[model samples]
Target chain A: MSRQRSMEKILASEFVSIGELVRLSGCRYSTLKFYTEEGMLPFKQEQENLTRRFPREETLVKIKEIQDLKKQGHSIPEIKERLAKKM
Target chain B: MKELSFAQNFSVIALNAQDSLHLTTAKKVFLRCMAAATILELYLDNGFKTEGDFLILNQEDLNSPEISRYHKAVLKTLFSKKETLSEQLPQYLKKVTKLSKKMLKEVEHAFAVALTEANALEEIPALLGCDLEYVTAGISMKEYRSNSELFSRLTESLRAETLETGPMTDEAILMLWLLRESGCIHDFFSREELKRVAERIFELQGSSSLAKQVFPITIHKTIEMGIKNFLKSKKDVMSTASGSGINFVFPVIERSQSVFIDTEKVFANKEERLRDIKARLESKGHIFTVIREGEVPLIKIDNVLYEAVPSAKLYRIPVHGVRLRKYPLSL
Candidate 1:
């Protein structure tokens, strides 16, 4: 019934690939890769195929937070600092 | 049985007459409706199709219920299916739409003329929000009596052209012709005034060129003439003073006697010689200045000084007559 719960259900039902995530998030594929490389986002690599995958719901939330911080004029270092504080 | 046959024949004749009349009227109405529809189609294609598309209906469509109703249905259907209407409709529909408009208007006018007493014709113009005056103003009343007459002339002129040439093209041509004939094109400016302005510009350009060529020479000539005139005036003044008994005396002691010489005659002769020299200087426009001491005078000519004694003797002297150097002269 809640908006967040409904979004989580949709994400769990859909197997959104990296390309789909880029399209949905409106972020560049290289930017997403950089985020994963920088440990800004948590992702997984398939054992046999070596393809990168992300938990759709968690990645979407993290992307939304990052976008919000950018809109608030936060520098990447500031964002990392805030993320570290959260951790 | 014979009377029954006659009645049947009469009925047949009546039916034929009615059918012919209906067909004629229906054809006219159908044409007008088609014209109105075509206009609406044009408006839509041109992107001006709006809620007031019905305003394009001709006089006949407004007058005849059958025609007006048919036009209304067509418009409704057209607009409903506008999203799917083929772009080619405008091309194909132009001729039929024009023909229909002409037929409908002709029938409506005829009907109005026939049923004058019923005032049926007046209602049609009123419904279309047009009067004879309004329609006349829309057309060139000087050239044509009615809208149909104007349109016919247009059609005749453009008969060879394709339907892609719109009605506006003809109207634009008519306007251009009228404007040309009325001499309205000359309202911009008079050609004679423009010519005069051009001439003035050329004259100014020539004057500037002449000024540029001759200005420095004129200034140099002016300075030279001024200096020559000043020198001539000074020489003339000196000559006049020498001739008017304004005596310039220079004292002389004879070196042979070591005493004053009886030089009155020599002084007079020296005065005459000085007068002659001053006259020559004046004629040649030579400039000089005179320096005077007690009973002696020195004349400066071109920055060189000359001393004249009472006798017929003269000598070149220094500028201030200090006698730094001297040259004796022949009498």
Candidate 2:
């Protein structure tokens, strides 16, 4: 599977770094950090490493869902509650 | 965050609580100030020289990357015919009107971009409608409140009693003048305080670095006179059109599509009506050509020619509760 697959396919199989998430979502790095801290987005990190990795497709969808809730005039806490219930 | 220019800052201050542009008398004045301030910025940079009554462009300064697109558009307008005298300010405005509006739109977009970069405003393309051409975003309530506070600070800074200090900064003077000319001064000052505010503005004008440049003041006055004359002429024509000779004050709706202008408001005089229609169409994103075939102004929209007139039939739009007349250019 590794030998036949393209680099993009291999990369998409695993989690994406913060920068990749920023590029994919068109969101600022700080906003991603905020979402992570608020528990609206989930991330994984390796032992003894500082880098944060987000599940690419799920994070992108969650960002859109949060923004849609915001457009509907939801507060941050309310958005968190809604996302919690949805999850 | 990138620091905004005085003109850009003026736009932020003029925005209403919802972050949308407030289409008021202040908007007209703001447009004029944006033009004046951009020209003055170029003048300060030695890109334009005042020769007697005309402002002659220095073509060498036109290519600098530091010069903003708004400034460059103003420079390009001045470059045509090599110079723009005080008397020609109205025509100069007409040529640069579209670019000036784009500049206004750019301010909001630029501010939104800056906010997103700082992570203050959220930039979700799907929800916020961010696209290739426009980068719209959602402003947090916190940011909105901060903006309101900033506007209050600006208002407080210009209080008549606060002018005990002798000389004001150049930006302050320009902002003061913009506020006063826009009739927004009434919003911030009482009748008694207005007299003092006017005095302070006059004093500031005489002392500011802009006054030393000369042509900016000339440009402001010429534009002011041009507006006065245009309004006076419109009033005379409108009164004449009424047949009762009573001057009916027409409400100027900000959105052109929802405009409820009376058919009688359309002047019988072709030239006058042509000017009014031309302005109305241009505001709705239609471009006009300089060449007028015969008496009618030729309006070109996306390579098609169409005459715009308000239809006679009035129907009720329950949403706005105002009578809607279909403007044919939109059809």
Best of the candidates, lDDT? 2
* Candidate 1 C-alpha error for residue B112, in Å: 50
B1-331 per-residue lDDT for model 2 (tens digits): 3345555555455433222333233344455555655654454444545565455555666677777656665555545565434433334434334445555455445444543454334321121111101211332211122244334434554442223233444555656655644445565677877787767666645665453433243223446446744654553343233411222123232122122222224234555455555454444343345334334344443333433332232235211111122223332
Candidate 1 DockQ category? Answer: incorrect
What is every candidate's C-alpha DockQ against the true complex, given to 2 decimals?
0.01, 0.01
What does the lDDT read for residue A5 in candidate 1? Answer: 18
Deviation (Å) of B107 in candidate 1: 46
Q: What is the lDDT of residue A48 in candidate 2?
A: 32
B1-331: candidate 1 lDDT, tens digit per residue: 1111111111111111112222333233233333333333333334232233222323233345433333443333333334323333333233333343334444334333322232211121111111112233552111001222222322222221111111122222222222222222132224653354334334433544422221221111234335534543543333332421222232121111111112212334544445544443443344556554323445564344544343322435211111101112201
**Candidate 1 clashing pairs?**
B31-B100
List the candidate 2 regions with Cα displacement exceeding 4 Å.
Answer: A1-87, B15-28, B45-56, B81-146, B160-162, B204-331
Off by over 4 Å in 1: A1-15, B1-331
